[model samples]
Target: MTEFILPSNANDLNFRHRLPDKRLAPWVQCLWSMGRPGHLTESRTEKFYPDAGASLSIKLTSPHPIITLCFNKTTLIETLDTTAPCLGIRFKAAGTHCLLGLLPEAFTDTHYRLDNELEPLGLQGLIPVVERLYQSDSQQGLRLLETWLLHRLESQPPANSRITKIVQAIGALQLPPQQLGATLGFTRRTLERKLKREVGVTPGQLVAYARLNRARHGLLATTLPLTEIALQCGYYDQAHFTHAFQSLAYETPAAYRKRKLSQIYKA
Candidate 1:
């Protein structure tokens, strides 16, 4: 399990440490983990939105059009012309990569400060193929394409103890928003600020997503009962756990497990 929580905006900021599909043990998700603004090629007008952490993103479905990437803490985002989207990958920190053919920067902070053009840093030469897959309306193709893309990234940097500890705590227990803030040794407001910049979600949202993700993995990786799973994930009781599971996953815990079991049996 990773130390940080990845929030998927399109799916209620849903999180999973790994791929849920059984056949794809090595798959990495291809779409934005946070809220997806739109279809891959919908001519997005970004306005300096904040995110959880620095990660790789690619334009897999655009019309092979040139998308611009600019770094401007002191200038305007519109003053720059379109750069090549084929090599559009963002880094959250510096000192991440030494070679420029795969990723653009060695930095991880989202504070953009430099002007980068179309240049592959991690991806060798397979951007357009992803875009073609995206155009075909094949989500499976898109996901499979990312398995190839994620393989090219540098290994995740050594995790910070501060963040890792938080992840571990969440694993052991799930608490309300205020209590969670206190556990982190910060006010809810402060926790919210740091999470938005570094963690990419509020403490409450992270807890919710992390809990749901745990239950998801438990359903696939084991055959634990709903009550047992609920207690293991730190829910107060089965009722509360069921409420949370349904709120986030759009299905009751038992129904979800049944669906999974059904899929496996059918296969």
Candidate 2:
């Protein structure tokens, strides 16, 4: 885990993100946590967008915390009631298969409890960390998690570096599925199978996420016209861009931009 940072808006939730250490960088993308404990008068629900990889999340305030293997989904509405805080270890696109000996596709659009799954996989000892986390600070909890993950790395078979590279390439170039196979020197079917097994989404889905992510960055960081942003992000037209953006973001690009700017002003 990383240092927690609260959002500037007093009414908003807290979100902290930290990059993994060098040794864990290949398998782990980053660690993140979010919460709204102080504002628990009414339950708050948030929409979470899809990303490129899988995440292992723990509901911190739960009495019996269960580690969940969460796969990327279309759009998810997460509600905070008694469990107002949560922490997650986000893995690289291929890290799930390498670390857990499981196909990412099985967990797509869903989550699985790791308690029952890890025991049979000889990973029962790692389950105790959840209980330990109840007594530890964020830094300590993250340390424990990394230690366990490193141990798992030592015991399990190595992850496929080639698949990792392919994922990285897709992100970097924002290549569409139809074009990705030719660039990566793999057939479409082979790429699809490997990504389904390791990354939990098809190449087309990954490309869509990449495009939307690019559009988001452009919206927040630059004053480019929506038309230009849409074209640059590979959308056929403004309508197409707006539809895709709203699907993932739950807001129009203009609205998202206004909200982001408002947050900046508040900060």
Please give the distance, in angstroms, between residue 159's alpha carbon in candidate 1 and its true position after superposition.
11
Candidates' RMSD to native: 12.0, 3.8
Q: Best candidate per TM-score, number?
A: 2
lDDT for model 2, please.
Answer: 0.71
* Superposition error at 237 for model 1 (Å): 0.7
Among all windows of 10 consecutive residues in model 2, the one with the lowest summed lDDT is 1-10
1-267, model 2: which lDDT tens digit per residue? 111222333244455667777777777877766654433545656554566567788777555666687766566666644335666788766777787666776664576777567777556866787778777766677777777788878777565766776676676654666576767577889989878767778887777777777787788779999999999988899999999999887899999889878878877
Question: Relative to the unseen true structure, what is the C-alpha lDDT of residue 228 in candidate 2, on a scale of 0 to 100?
Answer: 96
Per-residue error at 256 for model 1, in Å? 0.8
What would the per-residue lDDT of candidate 1 be over residues 1-267, giving only the tens digit for each residue? 222222212123221233323322211222332223252322223222121223343433245433333321111222111222222233321112221222222334334322233344333334545456444433444454445444443343333334434544543454565576677587868756654554444566556655666777676678888888888887788999999877665678888778766755664
Worst 10 residues of 1 by lDDT: 72-81
- TM for every model, in the order presented, reads 0.44, 0.82
